[model samples]
Target: MAHVRSSAIRARLDWVRVHHGQARVEEVIGALDRHELAIRGAASPNLWIPFDAYVALNTEIDRRFGIGDLSLCRVLGRYTAEVNLPTLYRIFYKIGTPTYILSKVSAVWSAHYDSGIASSRPVPDGVIIRVESFATPHRCMCLSVLGWLEQTVTIAGAELIDAREVMCRLRDGNACEFRLLYREP
Candidate 1:
């Protein structure tokens, strides 16, 4: 499986546990093996983990909760929307209007996603984010990521903001594109 920074995955589990309590978390991580590649418990925010683990954890959460992808996005969206990121992003994301913040989206996303996924760059009005595919594996990830982007901007002082999955890779398009629109207060 591919590898991704642990910060992206561990934080979500921590959020789930912190907000929902241990029993709910144990319901998922307890049965999974924490291998040298992936730790079962709270992983270091900077640790490296197999991407499969991230996928597995989400899949397990959905199966365990009997929830759909949109609901899962809500869980993560609320968590991310409410918290300020580290010093760098807290300032970077808030310094500009929603459009400007999104113009810099690639800066932060680059840290979490591998190059194979796609590339992001600022467009004239919004931003263009392309992904490798929109298959089953990427469906939930795309939705949740969109949710995160929406909330991230919302907290950053944007009075109005919108993100849409305009193009889908599953639809035989070149890549999945998220169009960002916003009005600054």
Candidate 2:
């Protein structure tokens, strides 16, 4: 099974606690506990946990807090970048262009996920990120990535004009791609 770093899971729960309050965090943990994916206690930042558990956490967040279309997963993803980038990956944003950051995605991808190869290429007004070979990819996961990429551009000192998923492995069974259009600040 694919795995995600524990820090990613912790960040999701942290966002919930900060925005929704401690009670909601407990409710979320209760929901996940039913599925045997307990996340109430902290885990080692670098520990690898089942990616499915991460997905379950995202799904639960969307089910309770979102509008049922799963779009809120994207919002949660943007929050992930907001919480994570400034502390853990700040230097990349400080010195890297959007393109430079895109180039480093592959390396970053490996650290966060045990599956998938993430790569990017420059487009006319932005960049196209492609995620391939991810085991058990889901639309919620893809949308989260779209949000993450959009936020990353903003953190890199650019104004994001548009961002959307161009392709999804769930539909095409190949890979997922996101198109992000931005203007330099």
Candidate 3:
């Protein structure tokens, strides 16, 4: 079973990385769309940061400053709406220590509002960083993750679909994977 699962994951990665050249989120989304994977709301016209670039940024920060308490890093992308559709900028953040792999961080937004009724504000979307202490095979972190995902999706009026896990380290020198996913409303 482990072999099969590993093989399946490898195959998926190969398809996404080799065949589709998923150097950017746009390419990954395109591949997903080509495979009939559903995405939340209308597609945005903005380009997504390449996974490597995003990782490099975080790794560099970690190496330079060392993990400190209350350190936050964010990656931003802009999506433009076409044909009366609302376009949103999705920002993903990597929070917490290197020894403990937690969750992915995401923020969904439409327009830029500072205050008042028309002020554009950031709506927290999905589990950005799944705390390692909270995740155990027996404990099933899915419930908590899903709870956060559901709330964010509901508030954003978007649909979220699949979740992907990326290997990362925690502050305690433990290796783990951080889970990330796309949603559809």
Q: Of the candidates shown, which would achieve the greatest TM-score relative to the real structure? A: 2
Q: What is the C-alpha RMSD of each candidate to the true structure, in Å?
A: 3.4, 1.7, 17.0
lDDT of 3 at 60: 32
**How do the residues 1-185 of candidate 1 rate in per-residue lDDT, one tens digit apiece?**
45556665666677767867878776677656654236463356666566667666766666666475545754564465455277776776677666666655555555665544555666654566666632334555666667777777677776435578888765666777777666565
lDDT value for model 1? 0.62
Give lDDT tens digits, candidate 2, residues 26-114. 78878886544545434677888787788888889888888888888899888888887755467768677887787778988898899
Q: For candidate 2, give the lDDT of residue 176.
A: 91
- Structural similarity to truth (TM-score) of each candidate: 0.78, 0.93, 0.21
Best by lDDT: 2
Q: What order do candidates take by TM-score, descending? A: 2, 1, 3
Residue-level lDDT for 44 in candidate 1: 66
Predicted candidate 2, C-alpha RMSD: 1.7
| Off by more than 4 A, model 1 | 33-42, 69-71, 81-84, 117-125, 132-137
Question: lDDT for each of the candidates?
Answer: 0.62, 0.83, 0.27
Model 2 residue 99 CA deviation (Å) reads 1.4
Candidate 3, superposed: residue stretches over 4 Å from native: 1-128, 134-142, 164-178, 183-185
